[model samples]
Target: MNDNLYEIFHNVYEYKDKDTNNHFLLTENLAPGNKVYDEKLIRIQNREFRTWNPFKSKLAAAIKCNLKHFAFCENSIVLYLGAATGTTASHISDICRRGMVYCVEFSSYAMQSLVSVCEKRTNMIPILADARKVEEYLAIGKVDIIYQDVAQPDQIRILKINSQAFLKSGGIAYLCLKARSVDVRKSNSRIFKEATQELEKDFEILEKIDISRYEKDHMFYVLRYG
Candidate 1:
């Protein structure tokens, strides 16, 4: 379990940030007669497209590490940054069953497709806006967790802004860092270290993993507000 989480952390950050398309939201190959889901809204071939938490995937590395501490409850609001096309965000919506999942996305092009898919559901809320400019809409309220999956060059800076304005103190956060987006010339460790330093200033980092086994080029970080 420890090894898997570490590998996933790296995998999620190694890929170049790109717009995603064609991937099924929550449809992954699972066991027969062992489907696990809450209330099903949409079905394909009589099977549900949701019901997958980290407990069943390489992305599950984040939960195993207890970085964001999402598994313990099904009732906290999560402010998701960079909800491109709502891929992983959809899975989060499944896990957060009773809670609200607010997806904050930027690309108007991506939002066009994402909004169409999201409007079909009730739990997920799509906000087409810049993550860096979170304060503008943060008046909504504090969030229990903030998931940062943006691909900007200044990932840490934007994260800090959201943490300050939206995240309630004592809440948790997950940072899915893409190495290519941060710095391709230096070693991945160096970039990770730099971001950790910035976060440690105000957060209590729980775990930092490689996660390369699940994602091609990426890293996943879990932190708790101090």
Candidate 2:
């Protein structure tokens, strides 16, 4: 394995030549000899590469689907809504090693798993609260990014509310729009267009990605706070 082939994205790494996948999110083995979500780990010169499974992570699938902008940076402070079990949150924490991720998950069961993930990752803070109620997390200050993946009919509303309360001016947000969740009866295209239009008032759509390859009926909307 040629380590030179691995491309760097903050703390993440993507191998240029790989049989299994095109892009991978690699992090320093925070827990030596341990794996999160049964992902593939490759160690080279004191660095470990975890296969960021797109099928398991909508953000990863969006990246694979040509997501043009990555808002997470070294100085980024993130508000992550619906961080179910911290699969993608773990990777976000990895990328924002110098920053932090406030992971909000409503389900008690999911929070249990997320808490476990937070135990190992110092950068991730697990909050067992509803995304709709941003005031619940008073400890969390303004954040550079807001990422939402809630599978609710009012998903766009949830994101808009959180973004308004938490997102800093000029901040970025990624909303994982589940078409079926919004309206099963309507066409996916119509739902996507309507949702995008709703968000235009508060956000500037940066990139729109179709992630059907890994997650069906899912669209990723990258937006910038206006």
Candidate 3:
């Protein structure tokens, strides 16, 4: 079952039990072959997620599964950690037109292309730093969402720190965690379960889907502060 933006946020029943939406009408349209991927993203970064590996970021799978849950109002502030090469980040920037995107990438290797991408795009502030030291960027606080796509073992811990420091009271977040990154010996389900437990302490988990066909043994979990 593909989860659109609305289903991710509104239909989860964690926030509310009723399925008020018609499932036909859509406010945030992120359908494949839509203008979002074609016209807008190309205009902004001059490229989208073609050359860069989707194996790295899970947004493509998120879009494939229905990207509606990612919908946010205009002018929203998004904190993106592990923004490699600015490919997926470019797509997000296009979707969130008129919004502020604060991207944090630790590797200088990807930053080479990312810097060039950011030079042309506005509202994309690229901060080269380890996400563990997220306190450094908390000065620019109260973001609408925090997107964590890191390949580290302690991602949940870092996201909690960043969310407490930067995310607004009712803000949302997305975590694209590599289960193998945390525990290679354990099964994918085991790793995901542990990570989910860690995340449930602060936020309400809207959906936890297996994203192995499009990617690897990774899971894209949509969360929000309760």
Candidate 4:
């Protein structure tokens, strides 16, 4: 409700500091006083908002880079792959307060931190499993959106497999492709092109964003599962 605070997307907001002229992307804090990854919290009109750091999250970076499609809603179920420490997932949790975010992570070390964050944010569910193994977490059922940030040679294949298993028809998917993970020798453009081509086989590319300013050699793809 602050005059400086503007809602950009559903539950997402932008706050501008008058004196400093610094703009920050924020989400209404779902856990009120809880802080995830030490992000700054602000209070406006009796509502708490958590600053979403674009430097720390590819999804936030994509939003900064003018990402057009935001399919996430207050009750949209999300399957978040490679949810390390639940930074972005927590923000998504704030957006989808009534829905669920199945946080799938491979590293046990990361899962420990993710679990702690999930505990504070009731909407986020921590799943300790590799993203490549979709069957391991099939009980999550169909989701409205799939957000993949896995770094692997088979990232495209992993997204396709998971989309087939969990994403409902016409559901949205956000793929954060790391070019170097696919092949160190290949150019970033080549890697992104190949990944896009593979994804086009089963999904429609809605938007392609270059998040290299925050994440080098990364191309963020917004796709709709067919």
Q: TM per model? A: 0.72, 0.93, 0.75, 0.98
- Candidate 3 accuracy as lDDT: 0.68
Which model scores highest in TM-score? 4
Please say which candidate is ahead in TM-score: 1 or 4: 4
Per residue, candidate 2 scores C-alpha lDDT tens digits across 17-115 of 456545455665565665668888777766766778889999888877777798788768999999999889888887888789999999999999889
lDDT for every model?
0.65, 0.84, 0.68, 0.93
Summing lDDT over every window of 10 consecutive residues in candidate 2, give the lowest-scoring window: 1-10
> What are the RMSD figures for all models against the true structure?
9.4, 2.1, 8.8, 0.8
Backbone clash pairs for candidate 2 read: 13-26
Question: Using lDDT as the measure, what is the rank order of every candidate, best first?
Answer: 4, 2, 3, 1
lDDT computed for candidate 4: 0.93
How would you encode candidate 4's per-residue C-alpha lDDT over 1-226 as one tens digit per residue?
A: 6889999999999999888999999999999999988799888889999999999999899999998999999999999999999999999999999999999999999999999899888799999999888889999999999999988999999999999999999999999999999999999988888888888899999999999999998999999999
Q: Once superposed on the true structure, which residue ranges of model 2 sit more than 4 Å away at CA? A: 1-4, 16-25
RMSD over all Cα atoms, model 4: 0.8
The residue pairs in collision within model 4 are none
Which should have the higher TM-score, number 1 or number 2?
A: 2
Pitting candidate 1 against candidate 2, the one with the higher lDDT is 2
lDDT of 3 by residue, 21-83 (tens): 432212222222333122221111222212212444477666556555664545778999998
